[model samples]
Target: MKKKLSLTSKIFIGILLGALFGIALKWLPSGTLKDSILLGGIIKIMGTGFINAIKMLVVPLVFVSLVCGASSMGDVKKLGRIGIKTMCFYLVTTAIAITLALGIGKLINPGLGLDMSSIVTTETVIAENKSLVDIILGIIPSNPIQAMASGEMLQIIAFALLVGVSISILGKKAEPVKILFESLNEVCMKMVGIIMLVAPYGVFALIANTFATVGFDAIWSLIKYMFAVLLALGIQGFIVYSGMVKSLSGLKLKPFLKKFANVAGVTFSTSSSSAALPLTIESMEELGVHNSVASFTLPLGATINMDGTAIMQGVACIFIAQIYGIDLGITQFLTIILTATLASVGTAGVPGVGMITLSMVLTSVGLPLEGIGLIMGVDRLLDMTRTTVNVMGDCACTLVVSKSEGELDLDMYYSKEENNIAKNA
Candidate 1:
């Protein structure tokens, strides 16, 4: 009897085929069939549809799963403790990511001896800086419905946590509400499974569209800068995350990566952590992270855990500073680390948001904003790579928190049969 291919294997195939198909399109001569019908018409619709399908699940999944997780915690203190641990892991990892990027950036010197004439400088509008107090206050939703409508993840997380905590507080009195949320959570998970069935096709369309549009020329133009960012992302994803999983959770790295590859492929194609949240949660559960931990940590991670973005900012900071012939001192380097780390919390888990936050980091260190425009052409490809790293960080943190809190199922984590079921499911 022949064995069936797992979803992870299929997704990987989709990514590979999609890249090749896209490159073929990029090389073909301009025509209505290539430009109008295929790329713009079929590819665009399919890619957008796939992204929308995933996004449609994010708000409900986060709200419902988080409610179920929080209500089931049974102890507000444990919930608070988990929250602290998760945040610490995210922040620390982000700092380390930027520091790593800085180190690599300095060593690589990607921007040294660059041709300034080849660079295009576009106008970049810097968002008005917000105080820490403002960011903290923004988390609390005055009207949660409005927050949900706007898809404000931080606000939605805050509201769901409150609702979950209240259900726990009321105990038997809130039993019915808790039951409803649990049912909703199951439905949402099922929804994730159903949507994921189309992921391979969706990933193909998305990746195809991306490469078809962006092509390799842009990447070659800033090859050194791209290499710097990609290198930092690779270290953060493979070494940093794998090391943390081994040291903190005592889980073998291979199984974790194997299980996570499907979600990582989706994340890389979509370039949006928010879009990949459902799969991330599902993958964590497959790794034996209890939904309570996966629910709370992954959503929060999606919002604030941006190791990948911080890496980009770090490398870009160095690249930009070098292009402008600016010598950054210890204080400026320190400021970039601090600013990028904190800015991760405010950065939305979407494509190109990192570029905006990179502006803020550059501003802090007195780097010219026009330097951003220089790398804008290649940011799309880099964004996809970094988003994969970001989601990986979220899952790794979930595993660590789940293990420490006694929420992990060791049997499930190590069971090949269970992992097969999860991949097929």
Candidate 2:
């Protein structure tokens, strides 16, 4: 019998091939065929379609799965406990991530000896700085339907929790509603499986489009800054997350990473944690995280858990300060950590949102916003790397929470058998 490639292997191959294809397009002379037909036309359409397909599932999956998960939890107290734990884990990890980034940034000195005058200043749009009180208040949706339509994730999460709690409180009377949500949740998972069938091709197109437009040249100028961000992301993803899974959950790291490889690939290619939510939730369930846990934590994580963005802000802060020849004292360093950690909660899980939040971090510590423009050229590539880290953080937190709550299936989690969710679907 011939062996077949697994989805993980296929996605990896797609990434490699896509990089090569993109480089080939980059080297070719600019023309209608190279720039217009292939790069802008086919690649653009395919990549956008793939992203849209993935995004199509996020809102429905989050709302339905979360509702089902909440309703299934008979004890509202337990739900509150889980919520508190998840939030604490997210905030602490984010703080740790930025701290790590700051340490690494100082050691690497990514912006030292830079010729600031030669760098092109890209325009940056700073996000409005929302106070903590405002952010907390914004979570409660006055009109949930409007919140859902606008895709205000925190508001949607708030509304979903309320609806789910009502269903649980009603018990027998609300059985039909709970059953409907469960069915919808299953349908959403099936949709995830269906969409994943095209993920390899989608990964290819997305990666190709990125490299085709922003080639290797972009990294040459800010190579040290880029290296700093990449290094921090790598440590956070591999070492920090791995340690958390091992120490907290006692789960085997290899199996967890193997199972998550496909989702990581999708996250890397798309550079949006929100777009990868469906797969992230499905993968967690396959890894033996009960849906009640996966559904709740992953959606909430998608909305607020932003360790990766914090890492970037940390590194970028140090890099920008160095470029402008400013010395940050202990107070500034502490301020960066505090600001970035809280800012993660308000930050949306999308491409380039990090830069907007980065501005806020820079402002908090007195770094020039112009420094953002210097790194803008390479942010796209860095965004892809950091997004993978963000998703990994979500999974690690989910695993820890599930294990702590006794919601993890140990036998299933440690099972050596291949995960056939995508294949079987």
Candidate 3:
């Protein structure tokens, strides 16, 4: 009879072992660890494959869940209102994050007095030169089958919203279809659970591959800029998120932090809210948040909500500007905030998207795109941190919305300590 450890404990062990394993490969003797088996490849392919599998589920899960949530509203206008409120919350918070990041970053001047003479320009990332027409038109796909095949999230979102609205209009006639969708949702959720079972192996490989290929010595050159990005993330995750959670709901900070530790660890290692969705949802449910709120807000948060990533863009812009000895005016600062927020909406929650969106943000405000190469190598680790904040923000938003809608189970929330008692009884 082995002891049953908590999810938190298990993940903590995985992270510890992953880090030590990674360090050993980097610092110690290579032997077989670096030879025949190729530890890094296993980590790279498995970790990335795990992420892709989860993302493959994202479109279907989100589409069905949104349709279910919206159909229940029974009022298109009310549905519109909720949509507005949710998007506005995400967009506003994102803009504020960028603003704070730029302000703090510039004040600190993280890139000042830098010598860029040795900076070798790597492969440059370019943003899709999307016109307003292209962006709007791209929202509704002509072929949803192709959209799903291609994993186009925006098209999937649009298609699902339409289906959900249509189902709501069908009234009693839609009951059978609704029942089928709900069942489909349940089956899909079970699949999410199965995917997470191998998470330890996947996560280990991903981290190991990342650290092995791009060792810390590679990032030693840009340590100041990296810390600047981290400082901004810390401020946003702790100060901003804490304030928002407290102000929006009467819940205290202590429990939120305690519950989020596991979720944060998963996000940091996985570098993806989409990948961490299952754990995040479970954590919120365990904390007594309603399924309706979690399902509605968390998926949306994974897509268009990227406060930490936006902060990275802000700091990067400043650093690049200083590195090139260019001064930014007040108008330009506002422009960066607006552009970063917009870029995040289109930024895919995947590895390459950050650099692409950062390129977009830089171009919008006339910043040099060349500076992107400087940070390309280290973006993976920073992505890990940013994704953790993304998941954290999602959970907090769910709590706030739940509390406001009177959907939260306060008794269950405060009874977190009663898990053992309930289990025993």
lDDT of each: 0.75, 0.75, 0.69
Model 2 bad stretches (over 4 Å): 1-78, 115-221, 417-425
Each candidate structure's count of clashing pairs: 0, 0, 1
* All-Cα superposition RMSD per candidate: 11.4, 11.4, 10.6
Which 10 successive residues of model 3 have the least lDDT summed? 117-126
Candidate 3 segments exceeding 4 Å error? 1-81, 117-221, 417-425
TM-score of every model? 0.59, 0.59, 0.59
| Cα lDDT of model 2 by residue, 1-425, tens digit | 99998655676677678778988988899999997899778876766666566545555766775587567656435589788889789988999999999999999988776534232223222235566676668768899999777655556656777888799888999999999988887777777667667767776776676567666532343688888889999999999989988999887887799988999899988888989999999998988899998988888788778888898889898887776567787767776787677566556543334555665567555566555544544566688888889999999999999999999998788775434544566
Error of 3 at 386 (Å): 0.7
Candidate 2 Cα RMSD (Å): 11.4
lDDT of 1: 0.75
* lDDT per residue (tens digit) for residues 288-331 in model 1: 88998898889888877889889988999888777656678776
Error of 3 at 366 (Å): 1.7
Candidate 1 matches the true fold with a TM-score of 0.59
List candidate 1 segments past 4 Å from native.
Answer: 1-78, 115-221, 417-425
Distance from true location, Cα of 64 in model 3, Å: 22
Collision pairs in model 3: 43-205
- Rank by lDDT, highest first: 1, 2, 3
